[model samples]
Target: MKRKISTLLTFLILSLLIIPSSLAHDDQAKHDADLMCVFWGDDKVSLSSEEKIAFKIIANAAAITIDQYSLNPNGRIKEGTFNEIQEGLKYFGLPELSINFNDIDLNIKVSNDGKNISPNTHRLYTHLGWNYKKHPNNDFWKKRKHVLIDSVNRLLFNSKKIFSWFPWASDVVYPPSEQCDAFCAIIYYVHIIGDHIAGDTADKLKNIEPLIHYTSMDTPGIIVELKEQLQIVFQEQKNSYTFFELDQKLSDLTISIEKNCDILGFIDTAEKCKKNQEHAEQLLQILSKHLPTLLKNESFFKSRFK
Candidate 1:
């Protein structure tokens, strides 16, 4: 009887020790999966070697644009910077974007003096970040999220479709207008290249749902708040914000969510909530750092191809 009781006690202790560790590992795996969904979406798109190089070049250009805007939000972009992007695209045989003067839907218009043209404020705001549109239904946020996923899908595959608007206008002048600033130029450049940089992977891409569906299955309100904040800041402020400002707003929202995670009682514990918050912040950091880092190491990226 004594031996049996001792063995039973040992078994109970071992179970207690092993079960938590196993749970922790499972939690970590879930966090990682959630982060992947936020960044890459549900479908996995693979890039070829040549396509990787093209993606890098375009990403670098975006990084350069972000860096410039962060430094001087109101300054004019350098002609050389624009030329470098154009040359990089040409080297990769990607389609160059020309202004579609016939497209009445384009947000560009003649200046007050009628001697110059430029993208309007609304265009600049929408291109640089998210924009809010009022809808009568509750699916507005979901639709907006779908738009983001679709843009990423186009970036990864079906890039040619992005440039199909003016496939034959190769010799057309870039900048479309001399009055283009950093905001106008970079937005135009990204819109053109984001579609085609993924090269021949077009057919393999798939549509994905919002990050909320994947990351915050238990508490989707948090993700909705995040999306709402992003749209409100850009839509209401016009063209008066910078990347750093936006980052702070997002960081604050994350922190608030972290604090309320336990009080909300949706997760198993405060520790799990904290871990999820950390993963979300990490995703934000990756986005904020990716472009600037690529631009800073532009030389290294270029040497890799050579």
Candidate 2:
């Protein structure tokens, strides 16, 4: 009986030690999966310049609508605000959004003195642990406020259409007839930027710096290196390289960066390195598939880098 009790206690101790580690692994895996979904969604969508401008206009209008509602004592979007969105949608020939101002119940309130208020559209502020009264005009809040506005625009205008379940299929399908708009692009952009910004200042800079360098035309670093590499690979192969070979070369470059580059200094753990590798692989595949066409538009392609 004494031996059995001792064994039982040992087993319990072992379980306690193992369970949290297993749970932590599971949590990390889920987080990576969510990130991958965002990445994949962004990669598959393409938007034209005009559509991009229209989306911006519509997004700005939506922000105005939210601000108007927040300021209104009645907690309703103004008729003018609603009309502006409709007009923008019609002008762009985009499908009409089905929101009624009367139907929205955002559960916000204003103080009697008009100085204090319940949280309105910027719920992300609360999520980030930012006290509105304390950090109202800081750069951190401003950047995140833009993200919130874009998210709200997506929620009001595009989410229902994009996320609606297909009648014949169990899964949600973005309608094929509709163009992939700002909604598709912004979701992942927001997720990645939001995730980076959630970290400490140093870590945030480390994470976002690579992204900024890759996206900005004025920044002469990773993107320029990528473009040069792409040119070299295409020139050497003369359009004869197998997709597999091209993918492998690009993967090698990214892996090299992952292992040795200071650009990814924020990736401290093996799990983060693995996740970054996977994201790089996906991006490389996109470049590989579009290599021929992208090369053909040499001037346009070169314009994307320094």
Candidate 3:
């Protein structure tokens, strides 16, 4: 009996040790999957200041919508605002302005009903304690990536249609349609393509600095930097299709934008398009109005040109 008891105790001790090891292994696998999903699939939309304001309303509406859906099937929790808004903004490619997490309130109205909030819109909200370092196979991540692609693709497709017919769209105020579309389309195309490409790279790198270092630069500078990097990527890949043309177009537009500024100029004619382009156009106009005068009047251009 004494020997049997000792054996049982030994077995119990070994079992306890194995259990935690198994759990840790499982958690490591899960973390890997999550990181893979973010790396290969997540492509956030970059927003200008005006766009951020507009999209905040959209994000809030989305949160409410998701909450309402959860109220039906899943019960609601008191919306503990965590890095959620910033995460969303970061995911959406907004500049992470110095807005403290404590200040931004994401109040989730929980109805007395028994349904829980759905986690489809953003996995980050659902998995709080998820580890992001370990990657085993990418199966779990692939599914998550598909979910995100479907969601963002729909929004982007719809955005293109709505923004094309905005009220502000006019021939005289904005550039011509071909020109405007070229600009708008390039932004959208780059967003989708670049995010898809860069996101995966960022995920593997476990940092966004390689893809988009928001702190080191502002919007225009970032755009220029990204353009140069992308040129190198395409060149390295020896891609002869859309890659070369897209890179050139973006480069040309960036340069054109830098060269001429017109305050009266606008980028969008429709209300449905994203506001960032409009704001960009507005900035260009301001520069155009001020830069020429500053240069010509002050003999700045003469001195430089001479």
Identify the leading candidate in terms of lDDT: 2
Worst 10 residues of 1 by lDDT: 202-211
Superposed Cα deviation of residue 188, candidate 1 (Å): 14
Per-residue C-alpha lDDT of model 2 across residues 168-229, encoded as one tens digit per residue? 12122433211122222222233333333233333232312243233333332332344444
Over 1-306, each residue of candidate 3 has an lDDT whose tens digit, in order, gives: 665455334433432321111111122222222222222221243435433333332232222211112323222221221223323333433322232322222123221222342332222221111112222222333332222222232223222343322333321233233222222222222222222232222122122111122233322233454354444323333354444555555456555544433421222223312232443333333323322332232221133122
Clashes of each: 3, 0, 17
**What's the C-alpha lDDT at position 17 in model 1?**
30
- Root-mean-square deviation per candidate: 24.0, 22.8, 23.9
* TM-score list, all predictions: 0.28, 0.28, 0.21
TM-score, candidate number 2 = 0.28
- Model 1, span 53-165: residue lDDT tens: 34433433333222221112223323233333333444344443332212112112212232222322222222222222321222322232222222222233334443522
lDDT, residue 119, candidate 1? 22
The RMSD (Cα, Å) of candidate 2 is 22.8
Kindly report which residue pairs in candidate 1 clash with one another: 158-202, 159-195, 159-196
Per-model lDDT: 0.31, 0.36, 0.29
